[model samples]
Target: MMKSASTASRSSAVHMAVAFIAMGGWAAFANSAHPMPGPLIAGVVQGTLSALITLFLKRMIEALSARYPGSVGTWLPPLVAVLSSLALLSSVHWLAGTPEIVRTMAVPLSVTAVYATVYNLALRRVAAGGVG
Candidate 1:
């Protein structure tokens, strides 16, 4: 069975995802009176959600590290964090924007890559307690 801490970690991820979805939905609805979502509204939703991916990952890492301790807790937590955040940031495509697509993608991708690398490096040195 998974430890209480791991369960909590999973729960936290779920909570983050739910919160983002809700936020996006509300923002989209508020932006447009009609049932259909607008391009700008959709962009806002994607941006907001993508922005929080790293935040959620960071929270999850802290929670897991504190509870699990050591390497398993350390590297593993960060590994999960980096991977999930990368996955999230990858899916944030704009509805209609060809002119600035390359430029827009570059900044976020570069930032996320750097963040993941640092997170991974730190996690690797975290002690490796007992949990595997």
Candidate 2:
């Protein structure tokens, strides 16, 4: 079940921070074999994007759930999130010239997919009159 708004805000902040550090670190490490400064630039670029996405993801899901009901609600949000993540991550990484683009994007994409799936399921259950 979800908590109070205050609690949710704190949790979201923590999650965003962790995502920024972890995903950025992973990107940097993944691209470490490249020339100097490349890894650093990639890390900053990816970290910023990851944090922004993390911040918005919950709200996106909630809005999507409310906007589209029933069967469509169950799947559309996750599918949208995954596709959007793919496009954003890939495009940004490409623009940033991030080395090993696929590798840099892998973990974040997987995480987004998993989070979207699990969150959508939870929303579905709650909508179906089950415990949230």
Candidate 3:
């Protein structure tokens, strides 16, 4: 049984929403000192980043679905993990007034994009060999 286009889209949407909410919740809980807006923005940022990463995975999944249907669910969460980890690692800007907390939230985001682009272009050269 193959998933229709709409089903795949809805499934992806749900996954994206869950990823966004989870990251926002975690950021909010971990850093209560910062304002809610930053965490909300961070969540949005994470969702956006993860969505981009998903595009890459879609290709691999399409090719593999015929061979290993069960692995789809198991293999997909790591992309979410990558997104959450990237979001947590990249927060550099302070909330509007909070100066004591210094982190490069945006830097990680920019770096993630650069790395993502590089990944898309040169995945065969680096990611193919496994963790560096």
How many clashing pairs per prediction, in order?
2, 0, 8
Model 3 lDDT per residue over 14-106, tens place: 755654565445444444555766555555554554555444444553343334334443444334434654544444223333222224234
Please report, in order, the local distance difference test score of every candidate based on alpha carbons: 0.52, 0.89, 0.46
Model 3: pairs clashing at backbone N, Cα or C within 3 Å: 90-104, 90-105, 91-103, 91-104, 91-105, 92-103, 92-104, 92-105
* Native-referenced Cα lDDT, model 1: 0.52
- lDDT tens digits by residue: candidate 2, 18-120: 8899999999998999997989988988888899999988789988988898789989999999999999999999998888899889988999999998998
Worst 10 residues of 3 by lDDT: 92-101
User: Could you tell me which 10 consecutive residues in candidate 1 have the lowest summed lDDT?
Assistant: 95-104
Off by over 4 Å in 3: 1-10, 55-132
Q: Which one wins on TM-score?
A: 2
Tens digits of per-residue lDDT, candidate 1, 1-132, equal 569767876675565565456544544444454334453555465457654764555656656666665456646665666566545544554433222333334444555556555654465455443222
